[model samples]
Target: MSVAAVLEKDYFTDYSILLDPYEYFDAMRAIGPVCEMPATGALLVTGFKEAVEVLRNNVDFSSINSTVGAGVPLPFEPNGSDISEQLEQHRDFYVGGDLVVTFDDGRHRALRSIANKLFTPSRLKQNQEYIHQLAKTMVQQAVMQGGCDLVNDIATPFVTLVIADLLGVPAEDREKFREVIDNAPPPGNLDQSDAPTENSPLVFMGTYFFQYLMDRKSSPKADVLTELAQATYPDGSEADLLDMVKLATFMFGAGQDTSAKLLSNAMKYIVDIPGLQAQLRADPKLIGNFLEEVLRLEGSTKATTRVARKDTQIGERKVSAGTRVLVALAAANRDPMRWPKPNTFILNRPKIAEHVAFGRGVHTCVGAPLARTEVRIILEHFLAATREIGLCESNHGSANARKFNYEASFIIRGLSELFITLAAN
Candidate 1:
């Protein structure tokens, strides 16, 4: 299809494109590395090089709109060649504008430093046993049931409790956290008309974390929460209570949601791809490479948004200041210029880490290491406990005409539910 034909459709809201965006991305890349979406006037970065350029250059591109994207209108009108002052003045108008993902430069650096405490090597090492035990128990239960809904039955609860333990959340509050997050719709859902302005699960999580941190500050305890509560900025000054709250809650919500979605995506590929499960089973080491391939092909985060802080160029395309830029991570990962036969999933693909599945530059997913460790451990347990794994024929139909449902969200790519039948080893 011609680029004009592709641009004719609003890739953000169009339901058909949301279901399977690969074809749409392919069409966009055919035009150029960066093409303007006439519908929203957002520049779509479909080429890997262009995506890297935008993601790495925080000087010219601001992440103020990272969470909301182009779907939401800027609070203030763009003036002259720079809207930096305007963005600051109206920052609160942007949805999730207070989030760490939306912060830039010094603010981002300071907040990220405090949040980094939760993912320290020693902290994750401490949580490793809990992750393994949970995965083993969950896999064993699925084996006994013969079939399971992978999203709810396994991934959601598993990742939630893991994060709870890592964050030092009280045992009594873990189940409530799980229930609130599980019931909340994933971000960027197309069906959510008020997505741009609506309060997310982060709001609720933030409330709890706010109270936890406040209490920790007043009554110090020997826990991660106390550490976070007292964490100082790089300047050795105390961080704001609200900023810490935002970082903590954002971590809890983003960490679990993205990780859970990733697990479901991995399982979908494992059962759908012929001989994949057996191959991973034979050589457990291959599971790491297999997971990378899955992430490259269908990572949980499909795309991320950035706004140009100043007039700039992404490849050959000129972007005006304040223009919204949609860095298509999924599309860029599959760019033929970077990956040979980008659409096909090749195990042990060379330089697999090069893919921007977890993003690039400073804003890379903070919980990435923990995510990789937990998902890999769970997959290992499931594969070890099961002799065979296949999709539920009744729910997904025959192999020839398989059917699956994906979350109706532009930003997130994940299965709403995955039904799988397993044979215990």
Candidate 2:
């Protein structure tokens, strides 16, 4: 067994070093830039240069046909085949938008044109007030309540509601929608026997949305769905409705959970680091630095997968066509070769943004700007409003056997719940 295989079957890697992940990554970096994980038959890239290579070299390794559950440790099943199919079904929907984060060539270019309008400098500036108001509401709701779980109470709603609003869902249905989606089973959980009819929230949502698209067809409002439904290709043809459902579910699923994890981790790290939090509370200017550093030190979503289009070299190992590469963003973010004094979190770390938390190249993360903005808005409100919040329970549900007791899951990396109590300034 290779070193990686041993590490996976047995968490021989000093994982406490991973409570601060940089250490583990640094060790991996020393073993050449990339190493193969025998356990999953996947290549693990830990160096900044090679990892970036995997992302930037689009022709050699394609992101479009990448499988989500290809190779990773997970507690639950991940239906790699079905999820991959659903993801690809929405390709034409982005015909007029810049789905820059996940597409290539013609599709990516089309999205770049259409999505540009939504993220224009003026649009972002205009939404500043709207963003602040939502952040204010989140803080206010938890204000007199004394202590609050940042993950469950504040972060989830603030970001989810904002994305929903941007997507054209009725604000009234936001809470109910968030509840349904947040707990939706992982794509792996889908079973052909079940047919999404368990009267579960996921079922309700799947049914409601398929029907919802039709209901919005007549005199459609100017929401994202309507725009998506109404959007035309270069040939002036309407996008298919099936594509719309795929995009809608992607918007909600990808937007809510990922952004919330970032917000939650960012806030928790800020509160946990007294000196840094105090600096932000006073200067406010440091918030940007704080954000970058958090992304660097504690990434939002941990890892993403890509498949090799053809034979290629990953670090010292030669990878053949169809090899699965697991880009450990969290580990790569802390790679020693990439950053100076890698493990420590200095709020003003000059090279902080190098972290691959948001990803890179064709499939980097479409929601990155929005995710950063949400974190910025919420943190700005919290820093200005509250003086202190602490983790009431540093609870660990399962003993982290791996280098970080990382959820034995393959795809998304996040807290099940980060329980905390907030005290007002």
Candidate 3:
């Protein structure tokens, strides 16, 4: 397709693209590895090798200035390509705004250090038993009900509670926060609105965590909040109070929704594939690979935006300085050159681990370990707790209810609602 033709197609606002995107991805990739949409001043990258080149080379493509405020470019771009200056400029636009994903300065490394300390491999492994028990409890509740909306009753609530535990929220406040978390809309849900503000979900999180962090600072306790409050940079400087608040708030909003979507996507396939649950129950070892296949097939994030710091080339396409680049991770994950039968979901695919579902390079999802552990435990517990899982005809209002609605956003991809019936084992 021509540049003008691609520009005419609104990748960000079109709702239909959310429901089905592989065709669009294939078409864009067919044009070239990198196709510049003149209207948006962005290049859509759908090739695997091209994406890795951009993601790993942060100097050429600066994520810092790409999404300065509310994800769009600021009025005045930072003068030079200094990572610190870019971050400082971003912070000026949005106060209390030093997100680990967007910030590319000393503070970014410091926040990342804190995250590594908090969610280590051993730490996540230790939490597995607790997560399994929690999943089992939720599954038992759903099994008793005969049928339930898997997205709401199981995946959504499970992720919220897990995040609450991870954040070290007091037991008293968790129940109240569960309601707040469940009702909050996930990313892409607000894309339809014009200049969508933080809305209810963000406002609730920002207000609640602000006070929570203050309490943690004044009265230290044995929890994640206390740890965050006392975290320091490599230079031994204490983390700023506002930065901590922003990190905490961002974690809840960004972390919960993605984990829930991962779970929901995996379940949709398991219930659709005949005897898959039974096979999984017989051999629990396959659970890990199964989860990998699901992630590869349906990653929660479809595309993330970046901008060229200086003129660069992705494949043969020449990208100019300050040009926005949309890295389509989902499309890259399905690159035919990288994987044979790229569209199929094969649990035992040898190269499954190579997929970029959690993204690549510096901006990879920090909550990845937690997300994996959460989904693995849920699947393990669900298989052990249920004899059979099937779609609920009454809930869908038809016997042939294969079609489903998805989140209406170009960025995040997930089912809006998933109703299922389960028989107890």
Best by lDDT: 1
Better of 1 and 2 by TM-score: 1
Question: lDDT tens string, model 1, 263-315?
Answer: 99999889888998999999999988888888999998999999887888899
Stretches of candidate 3 off by over 4 Å are 1-7, 65-74, 77-97, 175-185, 189-200, 394-401
Q: Give the distance in Å from residue 305's predicted Cα in candidate 2 to where it truly belongs.
A: 0.9
Which of candidates 2 and 3 reaches a greater TM-score?
3
Q: How accurate is candidate 1 locally (lDDT)?
A: 0.86
Error of 1 at 163 (Å): 0.5
After superposition, which runs of candidate 1 have C-alpha atoms over 4 Å from their true positions? 1-4, 218-222
Ten consecutive residues with minimal summed lDDT in candidate 3?
65-74
Residue pairs in collision within model 1:
none
Which regions of candidate 2 deviate over 4 angstroms? 1-27, 64-67, 72-117, 186-217, 234-237, 315-317, 393-408
Give lDDT tens digits, candidate 3, residues 275-363: 88888999989998998888888988887767676767788787766667888889998889887898987879997888888888877
Q: Which residue pairs show backbone clashes in model 3?
A: none
Candidate 3, residue 128: CA error in Å?
Answer: 2.5
What lDDT score is found at residue 69 in candidate 3? Answer: 19
What is the overall TM-score of model 2 with all chains considered together?
0.79
Task: Compute each candidate's TM-score over C-alphas.
Answer: 0.97, 0.79, 0.90
